[model samples]
Structures are given as C-alpha cells and as structure tokens.
Target: MRERQPCVYILASGRHGTLYIGVTSDLLARLVQHREGLLKGFTSRYGVIRLAWFEMADTMAAAITREKQLKKWNRDWKCRLIERCNPEWDDLAISLGLPPLRTIEGTR
Candidate 1:
C-alpha cells in the first residue's frame, strides 16, 4: 500500500464563525465525515465543516505539530494564511483531487 500522507486542515462554520483545525491521514474522507455530520465533535456541533485551508506534511507527527502551531495563531494570522492560497474560501477537498461530494454543495 502507498504510504499515508498527513494533512493539516481548517474548517469554518461559514465565512467567519467557528474555526476548527485538524490533522488527518485521509483528509478527504475526514472532511466528508465532518460535512455529513457523521462525527459528533467540534465541526458538527459548531457547523464548522467548510474546508478553508490545508497543508500537506511528510508525516503525521509533522502535521500534528503544524496543526498545533496553527491552532495557536491569532485570528488575523490564520485568515492571512488562508487568503494567501485560498482567498475565496473555496473547499480544498476537491482541489486536492478527490471526488466532489454533495455535502460540500447541494447539487454536486
């Protein structure tokens, strides 16, 4: 099997509401889970499952460290980072080459 890549992702409630930062080996799958409200957690509770930003890492450990660091950054810093690459707040799941899901859009 191919090696698993770790990714750090941020989900937002909307344009500017709750923000959730997470690290996972399967970023697409995890994002789907969050969007479907299949997981009972921060994203579901706060409706923060809109993909906002992401960064790939060589390993899960590195991704975890980066996720922690980003979580600690102030709001402005996080916004700037997201806007640097995803100014329109578009979903990163599709951009990452995954099949589009309806959870991201009603008619996908």
Candidate 2:
C-alpha cells in the first residue's frame, strides 16, 4: 500500500481567489484528483485547483478536525493562513514535482 500521511490542504483559484479546504491521507494523489476534476463539487465548479498550502497531521481524524476548523475561518483569516506559508500563493503542486495541468473546461 502507498504511504499515507494525513494532511489539511488549501486550494485556490488564483492568488486572492476562491478557496477550498480539504483533508486527505495522500496529498499527491488527492491533488491529482482535484486538478483532474475527478472528485467533482465546489472545487471543480469554481476552478479552485491551485495547491496554496498544506499542513501535516498525525492521523486522519486530526486532519479532518483541522480541515473543519479551517473551513469555519473567515475569508480574511484563511487568506492570512495561506500567505503565512505562501506569500506568492503559488501552485505548490509544481514544487511537489507534479507537472502543470493543461486546462480543460476552465480548470487547471
């Protein structure tokens, strides 16, 4: 089985753009699914595919709880959280070595 590292992540449409908060045990795989629009919903509909930020957790339960907490945060708070680590709000997937997505239906 693949190594699993629980995490809380933030996705953005662009710098200072729409945002999405989620939790997963496998960040890379989950990132591919989001970029590919495979796990349809708010992310796909709003084109929130940029990997803005992420924080590791010791367990899925901890990740989920973190995700929930982030979701409840105001937009300003969320933006500050992203800026704390990603001043440029870059698509961190590229740093993780994932090739840039070739857009489809405005996503990527």
Candidate 3:
C-alpha cells in the first residue's frame, strides 16, 4: 500500500495571481483533482491550479496547522514564501512525481 504524507500546498492561477492554500494527506490525488477541475470551489472558480509551493509535515495535524497559518499570511508574505522555494513560480507537480499539466488555449 502507498503511504500517505501530510502536506501543506499552495495553488496559483499564475505568477502573483490568485492563491489557494490547503492541507492534504494525498498531495498527488489532491493536485490531480485541482488540475482536472474536479473539486469545484475557489480553486476551480479562480483557475488556481498550479502547484506553486508545498511543505511536507510529520502529521496531518501539523500540515493543517501550517496551512491555516499560511492562509492568514498577507499576499506579499505568501508570494515570498512561494518564491523562496520556487523562484520561477513554476508548477511543482512534475518535481513531485506528477505529470505536467498541459496549457490549453493559454490557460493552465
């Protein structure tokens, strides 16, 4: 069986665009859903599907806590956090072992 890792992740519409912070035990599945527009809500509505940043945690509780903390952070702080790990604001899914999402009609 595959082990689930707790993680806090951020999704973006584009560089410096709308952002969404979330915690998940299955990062790959979650990202897949977001990328496919399966889990409808803020992410789908805003086209915030890029995996901009993420941090793994020892436990789900810790991941959730970190996600909440990041959510409270101001936009500039969040941007800095993402840039610190992803200077180019690239989709990190490929680095994390997921398939790259192809851009369609200039949309991600």
Q: Could you tell me how far off, in angstroms, the CA of residue 10 lies in candidate 3 after the best superposition?
A: 0.4
Q: TM-scores of the models, in the given order?
A: 0.83, 0.89, 0.91
User: lDDT tens digits, residues 15-74, model 3?
Assistant: 899999999999989998998899989999998999999899999999989988998999
Report the Cα lDDT for candidate 2: 0.90
What stretches of model 2 exceed 4 Å from their correct place? 102-108
Q: For residues 1-102, what per-residue lDDT tens digits would candidate 2 score against the true structure?
A: 235899999999988999999998999999999988999899999988899999999888999999999999999999999999899987898988799867
| lDDT (Cα) of model 1 | 0.80
Clashing pairs in 2: none
Clashes of each: 0, 0, 0
Measured by C-alpha RMSD in angstroms, how accurate is candidate 3?
A: 2.0
Reference-based lDDT, each prediction? 0.80, 0.90, 0.90
Q: Where in model 3 is the C-alpha error above 4 Å?
A: 105-108
